[model samples]
Target: MVNLLPIIKQTLLITFFVMSMMLIIEYLNVFTKGLWSKGIEKSKWKQVLLGAFLGVTPGCLGAYTAVSLFIHDIIGNGALVATMIATSGDEAFMMFTLFPEKAILLNVVIFTIAIAAGWLTDRFFKKKFYIPASDKHFHVHEIPECTGFPKNTFWHQLKHITPTRALMLMSILFFVTFITLDEHLASGSFHGILKWGHSSHSDSDPLWIKITFFTVISLSTAVIFIVNDHFLEKHLWGHIIKRHFSKIFLWTFFTLLLIALLMKHFDLHSVIQHNMFWVLVAAVLIGIIPESGPHLIFVMLFASGNLPLSILLASSIVQDGHGSLPLLAESRRSFIIVKLLNMAVGFSIGLAGLALGI
Candidate 1:
């Protein structure tokens, strides 16, 4: 029973971070009107290179931006494939944060593979869009909301707190407080709660950078309180915070908790050490998970010298960060097909690397 406390704290801690991230990304997605990738879809290689560049940018933004473009018919299937291949997911940022040199090297390789694979997918699929918005099966919830400043004074606007704004404010405040308290209590005890290796950005640099960043973000939620009804409900609340935060928070918590429980009972590192097949299989299987957070396991294992380069490469190739989330939300069929292709690529590369001793 006592073991449960740290687990809960850690889970909630990660949930808070995930929630904050969703809030920011979703807000930006709404802010940009989802048309940021409009002018780049003119040529085949142009689209592929654009996707690769976006994918290699080191966050969900790249993938999400790709999804936005694809949904609007601004990019095609090949570009979509390229983006996913290039995207290292959220784990890319963490890897870069932890070991910049290795992550950068892996990213360069990924970028190269992504460009080639994207072009191949384009040639073979021979389609403009894998699952176009017109396809009866693939649907995106289109909420077209306009934004402009309201004609109210600042103090008067401060008095206006919608349910969503209040909720956002409270969540931000709770996370800020949690971070502040965690820093003071970070011993090896359960109260220290954070699973350093299990989470992202575990570099020696003062984790205080994270705290301060979130602190500024928490303060920024005041915008929610003051923004007019249209911007609040349509842009901030409906488009981003309400739509994404809860889902991301839930996924983050469950993935973390499940990984924690599994690691506790199973010696995964030992299980994979003697068996090349199991290592490759596990790498590809975990890669199939659509979310970016879970891949941190393979990364931390690699960083600790417990996992091999080839296996890590397999995971890196197969995983698409959060790039798949919009696809999963749009068309499960397309998402499944993409994952299958990536699995094949990952296995071939992983096995070939193992054979060549590379």
Candidate 2:
């Protein structure tokens, strides 16, 4: 078990490194006065192309940042969604790191689907939802100056890559380390507890105890983000986790507890172990539940070689995760409707891919 610690640490470190690189690139784009247009003067097709390209980026936070930029007229909406679709979330990186071959194929299939879907959606809504007014156009004579960049070359780059940024990256690396380590510890603890309880105890323990335990653990994990303030910065870790802690915790606890209970009550580990597809289906269904953080657990599970089916299914469904929640939270009804629509679209695409053996 201790041998696994280094692997976990490396994974977390890489995750942080990837996120840091993304932030540096984005900041560079801003400082260089590249793609700084209050609005891009590209055609709809060009925007769609940009969106598709953005979709292949690592995570939804990157996609959302792109989306928000477009929304504020830094970019356009069509490109934003295209990028969103292309993004495979942080979990994809974990997946690729752990299971390179499978992850690569899955990502390619998903990226292709996202591009097609984003393009169609953009076109469908452009006429009615995204009508551009004549007065909305703003073309500056020269690119806007980057106030954030220093005049000196080395200092300019260094300013964007500060100690604060380094700390932020280290913090995410710590988080990934902690999560992986905690899981191993928790698994052992749970197994021990269950074994001892089974031998000595009666079946009826108060439901309240279980519920309380679940709630406390869930809340504690969720609140960890608060103490880890660096996770909230505009860097990759920060952007990904900013508003997603609660949703991820609640759903993950719910699923984990439910699975635990079923395992205990039926003594059916073998049954579940044999039927990987059902687990995959469960993971996928959970993915569609609308949070990014919990879906990451699916990647962890994949890394640990637990439920491959579930990991694959979950990865397929939970594309944008908590990144999409803000958009949904604006209106409960719309959120539900759009989420369902997205799931349906995603499922159809995934199923088709699976059927074709792609």
Stretches of candidate 1 exceeding 4 Å from the true structure: 53-73, 87-109, 123-137, 141-146, 149-155, 183-212, 215-228, 234-251, 258-266, 286-313, 320-337, 348-358
Tens-digit lDDT track for model 2 on 238-348?
443343333434443443444445544654446646764565566557766554555665654443344444246435544664445544433344345435545666556
Candidate 2 segments whose C-alpha is farther than 4 A from its true place = 1-42, 69-81, 100-104, 122-277, 304-317, 329-338, 353-358
Q: What's the number of clashes in each of the models?
A: 1, 9
Model 2, residue 230: C-alpha shift (Å): 15
User: In model 2, how large is the Cα lDDT of residue 308?
Assistant: 41
Q: Write the per-residue lDDT of candidate 1 for residues 165-200, one digit (tens) a residue.
A: 677778777766775677533432221233434543
lDDT of 2: 0.47
Candidates' C-alpha lDDT: 0.67, 0.47
TM-score of 2: 0.54
